[model samples]
Target chain A: TQLLEQSPQFLSIQEGENLTVYCNSSSVFSSLQWYRQEPGEGPVLLVTVVTGGEVKKLKRLTFQFGDARKDSSLHITAAQPGDTGLYLCAGVVLQGGSEKLVFGKGTKLTVNP
Target chain B: DAMVIQNPRYQVTQFGKPVTLSCSQTLNHNVMYWYQQKSSQAPKLLFHYYDKDFNNEADTPDNFQSRRPNTSFCFLDIRSPGLGDAAMYLCATSREKRTGGTDTQYFGPGTRLTVL
Candidate 1:
């Protein structure tokens, strides 16, 4: 079974538009991470939120950990063509001990210029 | 300089044949991970090594194996490849989990494996 689920498997919008991608789970996580991957490349770590209700911002991208620790969201303000890629959400369970990373299906965003 | 590097960005293997993917890191991180990602799907963890110790996820297939002979190098060995095993394999490096921010992974460009 998939531990995490991301909404809007794919999205395409004109440049300068705002978009929010969500990650949801039925289980609570100790920490969650966001990654962006370009074609033919590995995913790059964008941000990580460890505490429930924690929020982190990177440039125009804002990341928020759900108050319940069971969900998180990535909001990109004024999306640009550069923002086009696959966005993935992964979480580490509190159980800890080199366990497998639980990943969401991911969202593919295409910001057309 | 590349922090993480995987040899043969593209690999083709015959079904039922054995194949090995190699990853080396310049970051000298202590943890190395192997993940498989299909088109538009989440990257799934195959296994990982922390130093010389190997940890396998319960659901991973027995055909997949990994070895980390040293801190900077890790290897993924597929005992028997199948058509379903065709996917992009990503290698990632991370410092020990206790190192906070370093625990965030740095990934290689990934090797796309084609199993015929």
Candidate 2:
């Protein structure tokens, strides 16, 4: 079983539509980071939410950390075709500098123009 | 522009052949990490280097080895490439924080490997 699970394994929508992706976990995390990876590339960090109940915004993208720090949510308003990619939420395990990150299955979003 | 860079965007190796993937960072971060990602799955951490200390994940196979020769460069070596080893290899770097697990990692574009 994956420590982190993302909902809506796949999403396809028209341009300018809004959507939300969720990452849920039973285990608590020190910090959770969201990433967007395109085909043939690595996951790129979008934002990081450390504190429980923290909410961060990057332009039209908003990220919220659960009050328990065990979950996170990403909401996109008027998502564009450029936003099409795999969205992954990753968090570092309690272990030391091994820097091992537990990743969610991912939500693949395809925005059509 | 200081960022992580990966060499050989695409690598094709025969089965049982040795392969190496290179990653470099200009960010000057104190930590470097190597991850193997198969199709439609999450990136699995293989190992990492903090300064000169190497840490390997418990589940990482012995077939995989890594080297951090200096601050700016890191290498991932596969003793023998197998069909299962065909995947995207990602390199990430971060600065060590006193807070430990809260550091945000910056990732490279990645190297795609194909074992034939």
Candidate 3:
């Protein structure tokens, strides 16, 4: 089974502070996706990085995929309380016409105002 | 807007009772999935249907079952609910990408199940 290990399982920072979360794996994936889930809600996709060494930014958030396709990272600049939530990284592996995603335990972020 | 929808945002069931959760989609995707997520944990895929084909994960418990009666709907049935079965059940849908690899999965708000 493919496993993803996320670092710093918990994070607490003040508003306007910067922080980064990392997801790493020993196996390669066809694509990697980032999702943010708030309490009482399902996870919402943030972005997907398919290419190696690719970087995509969503306003203050920047997401990067490793060149080897074995890791990914999410960087937030000037974080706000709205960013407080659980961040999950899922690595997608395609099997035949179907696929499965292996998710990390997730990083819980608490942004205090 | 096309999206996934789940019924009964919350459900309460007694131990050993059977409970069913429903999911529907407007996207007409060919694939629908059921996942179980415990508090502060990652979501675990229970099973999924590709068109009419049902696929179950190897480690999934036998008490868990799923049905996709048609293209637009899917159901998750948990037999003999236990305290361990109490968790958020999420339904997701995705269309098979013509370009290959995995297609983007759209998720529903999920149904939080409480076992008493």
Which has the greatest lDDT?
3
Model 3: lDDT to the true structure: 0.92
* Quality of candidate 3 docking, DockQ: 0.64
**Comparison by TM-score, 2 against 3, better one:** 3
The candidate that achieves the highest TM-score relative to the unseen native structure: 3
Where model 1 places Cα greater than 4 Å from the true spot, the runs are B100-102
Worst 10 residues of 2 chain B by lDDT: B96-105
TM-score per prediction, in order, is 0.95, 0.95, 0.96
**Second chain TM-score, each model:** 0.94, 0.96, 0.96
By lDDT: ranked, best first: 3, 2, 1
RMSD of 3: 1.2
Query: Lowest summed-lDDT stretch of 10 residues in model 1 chain B?
Result: B95-104
- Residue-level lDDT of model 1, residues B28-67, one tens digit each, is 8888999999988999888888888787878899999888
Clashing pairs in 3: none
Chain B global fold similarity (TM-score) for predicted model 2 against the true chain B: 0.96
- lDDT by residue (B35-86, candidate 2, tens digit) is 9888888888898888899988888999999999999999999999989999
- Of 1 and 3, the candidate ahead on TM-score is 3
What lDDT score belongs to each candidate, Candidate 1 first? Answer: 0.89, 0.90, 0.92
Candidate 3, residues B19-90: lDDT per residue as tens digits?
A: 999999999999899999998788999999989989899999999999999999999999899999999999
Any idea what lDDT model 1 has?
0.89
